[model samples]
Target: METKREKFYMMNSMLCLLKVVEGKRTTVEMRDEKEVTGVIKHVDGYMNISMEDVVFKSLTGKKKFDKFFVNGKTIRYVHIPDEINMKSAMEAKLKEMCTYTASMRVRQEIKDQAWAKLKQKERRAKAEIKKERK
Candidate 1:
């Protein structure tokens, strides 16, 4: 069975990989078939990110944003920049993340996850009450 610790490690690996791309011009292919190129300004452990000087392109045309935020779930593939040495960068980032404090977005993601669990509990309680009544 996959333990929670293992899952957490996997998630951290992804976060570290992305951290190495910080301040670099990178391209991200989103799930909706749109593509964005920007200088990644900030990235959290949850992969929630803010980018600056963004250029978004899709089949229709293109758009620009002074800044943009992307939810990690919507990202399909991240194109690592050509000049980056992946193995070294990943090793360095992993070390950094081990001692890193949670960013604002990561803190929010934690809150949101907790809220979702509470909602699920509420739903189950309601179902149990209904079952007793019936």
Candidate 2:
């Protein structure tokens, strides 16, 4: 029941929203001449954003409202640099690889330690039982 133009617009909006989520920082301007700036932590489907000090929830049927806290109808604009995006992507990949390698090493070490401890305990128990029997 949707037209091609509507689908295109929806896709474009989704892309824009993703870019905003991946953005390093966002600029939130309220109607009360107050501006909030910080890294966007999370965003919901309703256009709500969690910033440093404040949480923004989109208002319905309101272009702009008064009072920074109650003003739900504010503009949330985010600008991300291409270089930052590339850098973040590379950093993420590197961190993932490092985490995987470290996890594998830790798991191996834990298994080895557990096996060694079990063997030592078994030996000690066997020696104690033999001594008791004698």
Candidate 3:
């Protein structure tokens, strides 16, 4: 079971990784220390991002491409712009909190119902054993 704090952090990170940085001129540092700078074209739920007019730089040299697709798993760091609007980000976080809370409640209810059914079966079995003894 994930603690509430863990869930909150996960949600916040998702928002930052997906919604907060879309269409922004950003830099992504790969695990191999190569850096790519471009405008974000698209990002999937998995965090795999597509960028346009991308430039890749390393210790040796730099190369520019018309378009590039990066696997999320290989990404080490994503550098977002400093001038992001916090008001909108807070509003989006509130909305996501509501949605996440509702979904978690539904999951808890399902687990509770399953446990109740299992308990009821155990009681019926015990009752049957007592009846047989009588």
RMSD of each: 12.0, 11.8, 6.1
Question: What tens-digit string does per-residue lDDT give for candidate 3 at 9-53?
Answer: 646565334556778899999999899999998765556789999
Give stretches of model 2 more than 4 Å off: 1-24, 27-38, 41-50, 54-88, 91-93, 104-108
Give the Å shift of residue 19 in candidate 1: 0.5
User: What are the lDDT figures for the candidates, one per model?
Assistant: 0.82, 0.52, 0.80
lDDT of 1 by residue, 1-134 (tens): 33456437534566667877889999999999999999998776567778999999999999999999998889999999989998898887665544443464588899999999999999999999999999
Question: Candidate 1, after superposition: displacement of residue 6 in Å?
Answer: 14
Alpha carbon deviation, residue 25, candidate 1 (Å): 0.4
- Could you tally the backbone clashes for each prediction? 0, 0, 0
Kindly give the stretch of ten consecutive residues in candidate 2 with the minimal lDDT sum.
61-70
**By lDDT: ranked, best first:** 1, 3, 2
Number of the top lDDT candidate: 1
Instruction: For residues 49-123, write the lDDT of model 2, one tens digit per residue.
Output: 555443344343233322222223554444444445645654554455457658978999999999999999999
Tell me which residue pairs clash in candidate 3.
none
Give the runs in model 3 whose Cα sits over 4 Å from its true position: 1-12, 85-134
TM-scores, one per candidate: 0.64, 0.36, 0.56
